[model samples]
Target: MADLPRILVITDRTQVRTTVENVVRAVCKEAGCTWVLLRDRDLPPLERRRMAQRLREVTNECKAKLSISSDAQLAADVGAEGVHLQRVSDIDGVRALLPKGWIGVSAHSVAEVRLAKEEGADYVTLSPIFPTESKPGYGPPLGLETIREASAIGIPIFALGGITPRSGFSCVEAGAYGFAVMGTVMRASSPGKVIRDYAAAFATSSSRA
Candidate 1:
């Protein structure tokens, strides 16, 4: 809700959960990041719920929002900030499962962006502004032009996929509201420093506007 850079750091469940979660919480707290998207794929329902609960505890300490990628019901159960819907259909399902205050959607194209906005998403992730390893063979990356087009639709667009400290600011310049990074921050040798650099860049850009 502050006028700071909206940085959304995503957690990969494939990594060491406790270490990653702790590091991310620390980095976000220091950098004043807006939210952390906990993308735990394919875990059992109960385990996912537990992970969300733990993440909620850390995020609460940091005063940052935690958005779970799946299990909207579990997200609500654990008092998560929101749920990130991967598919369009999941949007309605999640909306119904979670409360009015908690819902986001992933958008790969302008159409999806419009649909997400129409579906009453809190924010939408528009991805592949650069080629990313996360979604192999998904399609060619939608460059900054697509992001500009989507952002013009008046919805808050979080640029995702292959976003790094170097490219993150450019995403904002291209009309994105923020940047969502997984490998860029999570896999960084010094995530704290990387987050600081990213925040600095976004702050500089914001000041020039």
Candidate 2:
């Protein structure tokens, strides 16, 4: 939408006390939440499609972009805005399939960030900037400098993992284009407050944030 969204809510039903649909609808009531990645990796195609359809409507109502994780064809079929690819995913193939929408990738380091940039990813989620309980095995946190280094790849880089409203500024200081998170919005009891906090942090440091 603006090259990329400033704040993205990564969805996971297991991580939240509420349903994914409810969480998306709740946090996206404001303009701060510009993106949602529907990441239910365990559901069957039909069930996931139905869920995506429900989320798609909510995103539309809020004027936010909705993307499904790791499924280009399914994303297209479900009327999502685009697809977010895995680290080892075939970008060229997915790009061919999704010739008309946003295509983002997961990256863990500077090399992968460069790869995504070189291979033409619309944006990349450079993750585990902090040790996160949700991603115990994604390697140790990369810290702020790694984020600064990765941002040189010339693609929009979103800092992921253990991102709270308090920590979002560190990402901006480290040169993150924005931040992507799950629990900050999903598990939040006061999701609107957290969302606004994130927006404020991003905005204070960025013109578009």
Candidate 3:
């Protein structure tokens, strides 16, 4: 596996007024984002595939990797770099589909993170680290302590949920390998600037470490 990106951009089409491709391109080109996870799973299969294809083209031009969210077959069909699984049940299935590609999962606890690692997932987004509108129904926030424990399990943990440029450094101090963002970037008026801020945060964190 290549060195994972310090910031993972999760897409939510509903949060943005413009097209996802434009946002992704801006972030990739300006913010220097190297990875994007396409998460518009509510779309019809054909539409999702088409969007994935378009995103793949856009990401390619920006020298970034595109990973389909929770759809291994579609990811394979589109030649994506990987797939981000929503549940552990899909790990084994996805492995067979993208043998050499990255496989990540969404985990909410230490046990779940352990399970993902044991199942051969390359990494995980341990989410809800802070209260956020993005996933309000995901129960209470897991908090930074969860990242402290989950990172010890040996998987590269990306702290998700309510992570912003200001709060992202705290996650790194707590032992997160990286952090993921959805609404923050997707809903930003200047998505590229947001990405640039995240990159700066990570750089500062790395230096202090």
Number of the top TM-score candidate: 3
lDDT of 1 by residue, 1-209 (tens): 23323777888756443476766776767666667877876778777777777888888887887778866877778787788887767777676667554577888899999988877777788977898876667678999999889988877888989887778778888998888887767766667777888776577787989
RMSD (CA, angstroms), candidate 1: 2.3
Candidate 1 achieves a global lDDT of 0.77
Show model 3 residue runs off by greater than 4 Å: none
User: Which parts of model 1 are misplaced by more than 4 Å?
Assistant: 1-5, 15-18
Candidate 3 lDDT over 17-76, as tens digits, reads 698988999999987899999999899999999999999999999999989998999999
Q: How good is model 3 by TM-score?
A: 0.97
Which window of ten consecutive residues has the lowest lDDT sum in model 2?
200-209
Residue lDDT tens for model 2, 40-107: 88999888888899999999988888898998888888777778998645778877777877888998
Score candidate 2 by lDDT. Answer: 0.84
Candidate closer to the true structure by lDDT (higher is better), 1 or 3 = 3
The lDDT of each candidate is 0.77, 0.84, 0.90
RMSD, candidate 3, Å:
1.0
- Compared to the true structure, candidate 1 yields what TM-score? 0.89
